[model samples]
Structures are given as C-alpha cells and as structure tokens.
Target: MPQFELANWLPQVAWLILTFGVMYLVVRAALPKVEAVKLSRAKVISDDLGHADTAKTNAQSVEAAFQAALVAARTTATKVTGDTKTTAAADAAARLKEIDAALAAKADAAQATLAKSQAKSLKSLEAVATDVTGDMVERLTGRRPAADAAASAVAQASA
Candidate 1:
C-alpha cells in the first residue's frame, strides 16, 4: 500500500533518476579505459604475429643457404676426388714405365752376358774336339794328324 500511495510517487521517481544517473556516469567513465586496453592487447598480438612471420621467413632463407652450401661442398669434394684419382693414375703409370725400363735394361745386360759365356764355351769345345780327333787318328793309323788340318776339318764339319 505504501507503493501505491500518491504521496510516495515523487520520491520514488527522484530516487530512480538519481540511481540511473550514477550508473550512467560510472559506465561512461570506464568505457574508454576498457576500449583502450582492448586496443593495446590487439596491437601487441598483431606485433607478435608479425615477428613470428619474420622469423619463419628467416628460417626458410637460412635453410636454403645451408642447402646451397652443402651442395657446393659435395661438388667440391667430387671434383677433388676426381682430380686425386687422375693424379694417382698418372703416378702409377709413371712408376710402371720406370720399372719396365729398368727390367728391359737388366734383360739386355743378361743377354750380353749369356752371349759371352756361349762364345767362350764354343772356343773350349773346339779345342777339345781337335785334340780328340788328333789322338784318334794317331791311334788308328800310327801317324798323328796336323793341328791345322784337324782344325780345318772340324770347322768344315761344323759349317
């Protein structure tokens, strides 16, 4: 019944207006700060995203550079290996040629020695054959053959 009373209406209206005005002032005062905070957070998040993008791009470029360096190293290694193989083959060929030359020289010397020994042996065999023939002729006919004749006969038989 106090709510319905005509004398309480103006006071109730005044209280409602006061309460609404205070609430409006409070909300109006806080709205800009809230909006500023929200804007600051949005800016920070954007900056962080930009930094992440830059880092990703840098990582990609670094990876590309590393791959390029690795490829270059491999190419250099292959070239060096090929060059080494060529050099080694050349060295081996040179050494083999030297050995062959030495062996040929040795063989030629051995051949010369063998020829000298054969000549000496032939001279000794001729002297021995001449002596045997003279002794055989002396025993068979009671007369010795001349040294020159026996030597000539042996030479003719050999020819």
Candidate 2:
C-alpha cells in the first residue's frame, strides 16, 4: 500500500469524535437520573426498617404488661386462700372450747347427784342393822335393853 495520507485519516478521526461526544452526553446527562432514582429507593428501604423496629418494641412492651398482670392475679389468689384457711382454723378452735366447757359442767352435776344418793342409802342400812342386832341380843340373854341405853348404843354404832 502507498503511505497513509491526511485525506484518508480525516474521516476516521471525525467519526471517532462524533461517537465519543454521543457517549459522553449519554453518560453525563442520563446516568444522573438513574443514580437519583436509586438513591430515592434506598431512602424508602431505610424508612421501612425503622418502622419495623418500632413495631417490634411495641409488641415486647405489651408482652411485659401481660406478664405483670398475671403475676398480680396469682398473688391475690394465694392471699385469699390463706385467709380462708385461717378462718377455718379459728372456727374449729372455738367449737372445741365450747364442747370442753359443756362436758366439764355435766361431769360436776353427775358427781353431786352420786354423793347425795350414797348418803341416803347409808342411813337406811344402819336402821335395818340396829333392829336385827337388838332382837338377837334379847333372845340370847333373856333381857331387854332400856330405852336410854339402847339409844346411846345406837348413836355410837352409827357414828
């Protein structure tokens, strides 16, 4: 081939400049809008994540409040049961004391009645024994005791 000339090289250089200018315009002007759209999408994603965190915190607070209320209810139930037990024990004690007092009174009255019956039986038995002894003495000795002597002997024997 002959040596390259400026006339042929001019068209190639002009084509290169035109292609580069178009590429530069596309990159500088259109790429910024794409980048701005991407930045806006990233901001929306960050805001969503913040909202999710707030919702999780609210759920945890509700759970804690429910647990506290359950604990308080259990404590109140236990206290009521304890109070009922104490009242039942007090009632039982009062009944036992009343029964003991009644039994003691009955036993004292029975003892008083027994003592009075014993004294009356002893007096009757002494009179019967005196009459039998006097009859036997008169049959054996063929003599009767005087009234005053018999009275004195009966008194001494009874004592």
lDDT of each: 0.94, 0.81
- Tell me the TM-score of each prediction against the true structure: 0.62, 0.55
Once fitted onto the true fold, the runs of candidate 2 whose alpha carbons sit more than 4 angstroms away are 1-10, 103-159
Error of 1 at 106 (Å): 2.9
| TM-score of candidate 1 against the unseen true structure | 0.62
Clashing pairs in 2: none
